[model samples]
Target chain A: MNSLTTAFFIAAAMILFAGCYMLVRSHNMIRLVIAVEVVMKAVTLVLVFAGYSNGNTALSQSFIITIIVAEVVVAVVATGIAIAVYRNNGDLDLRKLNKLNG
Target chain B: MSASLATLVYAFIGLPLIAIVLLNLPNRKFAEKLCIGTGLFVCIVQMATAVIAVLLLIEFNKASMSFSQFWDMHVADDAAYFSVDFLSAVCLFCIGMVGAVSFAAAGSTVRDKILNYTNMMMVLLLGMNGIALVTDLFSVYVFLEISGIASFLLIALYRDPVGLEGAFKYLVMSAIASAFILLGSGLLFLEFGSLRFVVLEEMLQAGVYNNPPLVWLALFFLVAGFAIKSGNMPFHGWLPDAQTGAPSPVSIMLSGIVEQMSGTYATMRLIDIFLLNKFTVVNIGMMLLALLSIVLGAIAAVGQTDFKRTLAYSSISQIGYIVLGISCGTVLGYVGAVLHFFNHSTFKSTLFANAAAVKNQLHSTHYDDLGGLQKQMPIAAATSVIAGLSTAGLPPFAGFWSKLLIIIAVWQTQGAFVASVALLASIFTLAYFLRIQHKVFFGPEKQRPAVKEPKDGIAIASIALSVVTIGFGILFPVLLLALQTQGVL
Candidate 1:
């Protein structure tokens, strides 16, 4: 693989592992949200890179990157709600909210 | 179709999504009206676009080209992409149709956050459409999250504690599934350096991975991801809670068709495109999962007293039919899976409308709490019949023909034993639906429904959806022809 593609996948892999670790490790809702962002970012990085080496199409690459930035607000909207969830419950240890488990 | 079909295609996927942006705009009152009006507008446009999409599918099928050419890879000159055929059009119609009907019905009930509800609904439809159309692996993953998160939020719309829990559970399962894809995508990245399903198939066939175990493991991870999303068998724990707790409109979307779109599309794309070379075995495993889903879903339904929970299990059974068809792997099987997916969307959503209506009228989702609704909401009772009869595969209903097709197709290859098993499963489907209908609608007239019926979009969509169910149920032949043009029949 070219250095560009190799570098891209390596960083994406690191981001993904880090995100998963954070998602598992953090009980804080905000941190979880940020971790989810890391997952999204990792996917975006890997996708753009894949588009670059594989599809090699300008439209697909640009489109993938644009989707990354474009999705922030929507993600944030959900995060805002998550924050509200934290406020109401006093903690983000999601296991405590078991009302729906039945 | 011009290269610009992508543009129109993008619009069909973008409009509802753009509404999300519109919702946050100034003036709360306008946001509500705009959301409803925009939802209705998009529904109409989506239905129209669905029609055009069907036409496009016919053209593409006639030309025998379900693959589109977008761009190229480094070593690979022409990358493979998907073009619409019957399967996608059917889903597109359901997504658009149910969306329009339900949004029109849900009006004003989604108070306080008009723009948010409307925007989420549209964006949900958009993500679904993107999933159905895009053949790109990465694109599918992105859209799946978009749609899935939108769904989670819709369930959380009521701000009930249960809704939050529902969202969290769904989020966790969905996150795990997405990670599975990323793992596979990462591996595939190292191998093919590409993510397009069509292109990856060729590379893999040429033995790009070189490790047979790696290939098997990738397929397992990928399939598991989709299986989790589709809620197949053991992975289906999230459906009842998530679907029941979500808003009625979201329930309609989720139960009616969202999972079918994402879950089935992912499973199918992985099986058909990535491992078409190994589908004989893979499909058998899928078939086994289908049978298990049918039995467990019905058994699970029997235990549920909640009206919406019962409907959720029914969805599990409904998903079984689609998976079973794919398992058969004949042209008939593919066609059956596609049509079953579509039919489930129509009737399931209609059924959820009934459940939603009952819940709205009674303020209770428990079936035992809701009695004699027929006297109170005759339309819900009648429409519930439409949904129930159609889904249970009674004669002259849309589901009947599809179920018959699945049975016959299965019989052709698997012999009388499997066909008999299929026959028995349908009976189980009927038994539970009949039990629920009787308990919820036909039971003795009790005190007034526990909750007052809200003047909301549920009523409007109930009528609209009922009309669709009856219309499609009766006009089976013409519908078949339309689907045939798109290769579903």
Candidate 2:
């Protein structure tokens, strides 16, 4: 409800929306990953703002720590998969990653 | 009773962890049978735990007039963040049954990396059980991540081009879902200063939040997050690829259990927490999405030439029925939804197992590659027919009864027009399945060479599932009575 808190919330939502837009637009696998990470960063910002607004900073901090750990694992695995896909298909474009079409 | 139910939940959660460690004994050489034996034992124990949980829940419900109050307080008093009630107990039962059956159906498919496969599977089971039992929103997110990672690994088990592609798609979508969920949880925590489901439910019921729009924003994010996780319409791009790309048994688990738990089950839990009091937005959204998936998935399935792809689309269609049932927001609708969930898992796993059997023999499941396989793989062929009929909601099969209940529930709530359309969709379901049967089982024998039957494990698994489908339908009254006793009806 404070002006600063409201500003943070607005910024967080804008960043998340921008990241999602990028995710939808990009076909490059690495770029897609970056977009996802950006969204996650926005989420982290929201969580921080949440904790601040709710006066539960410790809980939100712990949640952010766990989220970071999990995010790292997902990022590593996705990067590995992206590299494998690129090596196999000769590109990182999702449009080209279509060997198993419906 | 409450204390023991809590213990049972912990044990159910712990079972898979134990299996994970046991399957990964560093010094010991693991024979295929030994690894499978371990998996089977763990699965059986999971089912046993579910059975006990259900029985205890029924007894507790009978003994207490204030079931929800006791249920809410029982585990909130405990420092641990897990709990179980009738809904969770039933979900655990479905998870156990589907997971066990999937392992049985896996059979020889996992012969190469039996230890690794079984370990990952056990971890997946752990994650699902954890998701079902946990009462806190953060814990749900944590468990969802656990299962999500396990599924990505399992889908990419072969590490081939298609597998990797499928896994990447799954990862990207899942990561987006996670972000949405985390953001939603953050908003919710800001509203209530807590992440516990009970606390949130109380706060919502008490109208404690200041900003209604923020509450709606959180609910929207959560619902969208779970809708993506569950593979609803317009967000189901990863499902067909993931199911088709994974090994058949993994497909069985993915299509049958994982989607239900992570997607529908999780969505249902959230609805209970946040949407039950104000049903207009979530209910209407879920209904519209369900209708879209049912129609589109069926139509898309009708055009697929690949056997697995057809099944994948069919899963989307069938999951639509479950969602449709839930969207009605009536007790009859809930029963129908839960029953359909159980039946879908049964028949879908059966169909996937048979697909694996076909793949095992032909090295492909394309319509062009398969013809008149009934003579060669009679058990699989027969079971596929049964499963196909069941999936189409034919008479004397589990799918029929569940679909009937769901239609009736929809008629009562959403009215006759929607229910009638749902019934028409079943015709689409039957049409495609019959086409598959004709193409794969009754077509002219293109190849005169000897056709091998399904291996013993898959044969037995499919047969068992087929029998259960038929038996559950025939014995619907018994099941209804049991559910009635448990206060689910």
Candidate 3:
């Protein structure tokens, strides 16, 4: 593989790992949402790189745009639920959201 | 004939959009009053359309019929279009049946939120229909998101603490799954320069890709993503929580159709296009996952105290059967898997409807709060028995024939040990369901206020689904004979 492609792959992998780390480490609900967004951004980078490598940048561009739109809606809904959870428990701590269990 | 087929195919996507538009065009009060009727109308039409399309396709001796709604966009060589074949027709029918049941239950359970419920239900139906009809992987992702969003909002509609928690958990896991799926598809697109199923299938069959390792990596991500979406064993933490926390009607929708459409259906399509009759390692991997889910989900369900939670875990187990059938990679296995998918929707919807009935009358579905309900709620009790027996794969119930077919296919292909393991798991299914029957219906009477049967839409929905389950089970042999006569078996 070319040096440019290698660099892109490393960057995407690093971003993915960082996002996953945040997802595992965060104690706050809003931070979890941000972590999900970060992961999605990494996916976006991969899609863009894939398209560029394949000489089909336009299709990948459209795909990325659609992904952005869908992820935004997901973020809105996640934040909305998080806000509702906060109102119920008076905090955004992830540990407090465990009422249902086996 | 083709023209009529096109119209019928279009209805699956068009009717729901029309219903959404008409419902919202009126004023808020008017929409609220008309929402249930509109929802039922859309669902019934969709069910009828699916059956008719399937019949027409058969009569015309065609494998599938493709159609577009607004305008024909065949300008490019590989522009995406929607099509309906036997498999998708079956899925569409399941979506319609389950959507109808959800709407019926919602009339009683979600009276105040009826309008919002109907709106989101239509969107969910639209999304599922898109998933069933779309010809490309990217389109599947789009429809998955649409349905995923609708379900998350449905779970959080009441915004209660538990509902919010369920929705948040579902959203987080689902988002991660989507990232995995998109990355996989991106990797595929990088190699193939197209996302159409037919093109990818052809390319894979020709075996001319430059980057074989990249293809395997893509497959890995896709499998993991879909496994998560389907709530298979290891990735099943959110399923029970979401199902248990959602309101009863929404629970019916989630367990009945949403999870199957967004997850298992995609997996089936992926297998059809990518792994069918090849990739034995992937097939074995999927089979192992299915076995794990089947054994563990049933064992776990045996210990749950709550009504919805037990059924949720049971759903995980039942879905495992469907995946097991798929992983066999034979025509018989595919047929068995599709039939099992249909049976699961019918019986699971009936069970959830019974849960709604109990919750409505007693206001609690905990084992501690339920006892001797059979004497009072005769219909729910009776239907639950039928549905539960069907789930346990007893004779003369719909679930039995499908499970038997799956086990036989596994035996023929994967060997006796795997088949025997699957067969033994049914005993656990029966054990847990009997526990439900004993704890919730036939145990010693609790000294509490006398409860009556829920004289509402939920009761009617459960009865109808129970009838379908019983009818399908009894008629399956005739169907097999007919298929044999046609040289299809």
DockQ of each: 0.24, 0.80, 0.85
- Tens-place lDDT per residue, model 3, B23-125, is 9898999889899888988899999998997888789887777665457633233453887888999999999999999999998889999888898888899
- RMSD after Cα superposition, model 2: 2.9
Residue range A1-102, candidate 3, lDDT tens digits: 578987998999999999999999998999999999999999999989988988899999999899999999999998988888888889999887889962
- C-alpha-based local distance difference test score of model 1: 0.73
Preferred candidate (DockQ higher): 1 or 2 = 2
- Which residue runs does candidate 3 get wrong by more than 4 Å? B73-80
Using all chains and alpha carbons, the TM-scores for the candidates as numbered come to 0.84, 0.95, 0.98
- What would the per-residue lDDT of candidate 1 be over residues B69-151, giving only the tens digit for each residue? 33421222244354565566667777888787667657534556566777778768878888987767777877887898788
DockQ for model 1? Answer: 0.24
* Candidate 1 collision pairs: A54-B73, B105-B457, B105-B458, B106-B457, B362-B451
List the lowest-lDDT window of 10 residues for candidate 1 chain B.
Answer: B69-78
Best by lDDT: 3
Rank ordering of all candidates by lDDT, starting from the highest: 3, 2, 1
